[model samples]
Target: MKPFKSYVVRTNEENQVTHQVEEVTESFLGEGNTTIAVEYSSINYKDMLGLQTKGGVIRNYPMIPGIDLAGTIISSEDPSLSPGDPVLITGYKLGTEHTGGFSEVARVPSEWVVKLPENLSAKEAMMYGTAGFTAALSIAALEKNGMKVEDQPEILVTGATGGVGSVATQILRKLGYENITATIRKDYQEESAKEFGATKIWNITENESNGRPLNRREYKYVVDTVGGDLTADVLSKVDEYGSVAISGNAGGVKLNTTVLP
Candidate 1:
């Protein structure tokens, strides 16, 4: 059989990172229970990291950098998964530690695959990818933590213009949450946030930090896609018994806050 095309990332001994599209054979795929004909994949921040000189995301050299993929199963050794089945794979050290979705053909453990739901198409699933999945998962976690849309009408979403934040805002609105506050760093994103179902917009760059240990409670539930000090800020302002779901660390990874709030 002919080699399939794939985007490959390689790092040199001097820490120079190079990315290019190349043809690969099945032998390069390593071991897997399933082989998928990848139809869709999305470019994410992680993908950019893989192309950086010292991004530290790639565990090995000569890798494919895409965390999410949706496609039809070309073959499967696992009894549960069959050929021609539509499936989606995300996370689980995909782009970082393994041959990822940047290739026309992707092979992964069957355990890492999810049967594509009937309501969603392969392209649509890629549109959601890790970003949308994170949003939905964060909201689900909040709900599971006793958060109620009816009670917590004014929920907060940070990094509102981002992939996760935008999808989270829209999902909240669709779920009947009337008051969604989307916090953004840019002024121009306010209207876009509102269009994504945010009723209020808070510009993080324009807003001043009070530097207090705690602040008045404004929201019962908050989705903090951008973590670090921003997460600490959101946690401090959450109402008593309120829940905050933090899914990303784009801002920073460290959380510096008092135990009081």
Candidate 2:
């Protein structure tokens, strides 16, 4: 009932961006059919961008910046949802084109909300957030393409210390995949990668280019979180009939590759 609080990002006339927690009211919330009393929100890499000067994430000024949130619905215009219903939401333009979940309250399109599963707590759901969901989807896509744990071929995960890659590595281990390799940029990350059940840890140099058009087939499956030339290199290294699921572009955005690879 009282004015709520949120972290808002605004670009000033001087072209500097300021981000801080501030008080807000219902009117400040974005257009949506459902209003939720937010219980938890997780910070992703995208959330960090909104705080930067030229992060290129916010499509508008004075925005709340969280990509995923979980909470209990306080009100809803849609018939399928009602007050006190537990829910979680991600994507559908949240934190990009719309006011996001870094607040005490969030108003979002009803279609963007999903009923929280009975086994998952709101806090637990936020722990998964966008990065974890991305990781899950990446694995699901690989499975849909016929990658199975039973076959037991070596699986590769790029950027293995990152949010998506780390979670993906652990999830793969949990699902009975024993031969998992994680690619890291530094030597110190080998232990961390192993904690995620990576059977082997590779440096970026080992998996990336040495200027070959197509290298020897190495991995049967790859969950690539870094896109760019690395992706092109990964493509060339994939075994025949294998598939790759790419989900991030932190390395770069452009890809130059031949179909032969």
Candidate RMSDs in order = 1.3, 1.1
Q: What's each prediction's TM-score? A: 0.96, 0.97
Q: lDDT: which candidate is best?
A: 2
Tens-place lDDT digits, model 2, residues 4-60:
999999988998999999999999989998999999999989999889999989978
Candidate 1 backbone collisions, by pair: none
Candidate 1, residue 118: Cα displacement in angstroms equals 0.7
**What is the RMSD of candidate 1?**
1.3
- Candidate 2, position 228, lDDT: 91
After the best TM-score superposition of candidate 1, give how far the Cα of residue 126 lies from its true spot, in angstroms: 0.6
Query: Which segments of model 2 are wrong by more than 4 Å?
Result: 206-208
TM-score of 2: 0.97
How many backbone clashes does every candidate have? 0, 0
Local distance difference test, each candidate: 0.89, 0.91
Worst 10 residues of 2 by lDDT: 205-214
- Expressed as tens digits, the lDDT of each residue in 109-146 for candidate 1 is 99999999999999999998899999999999989988
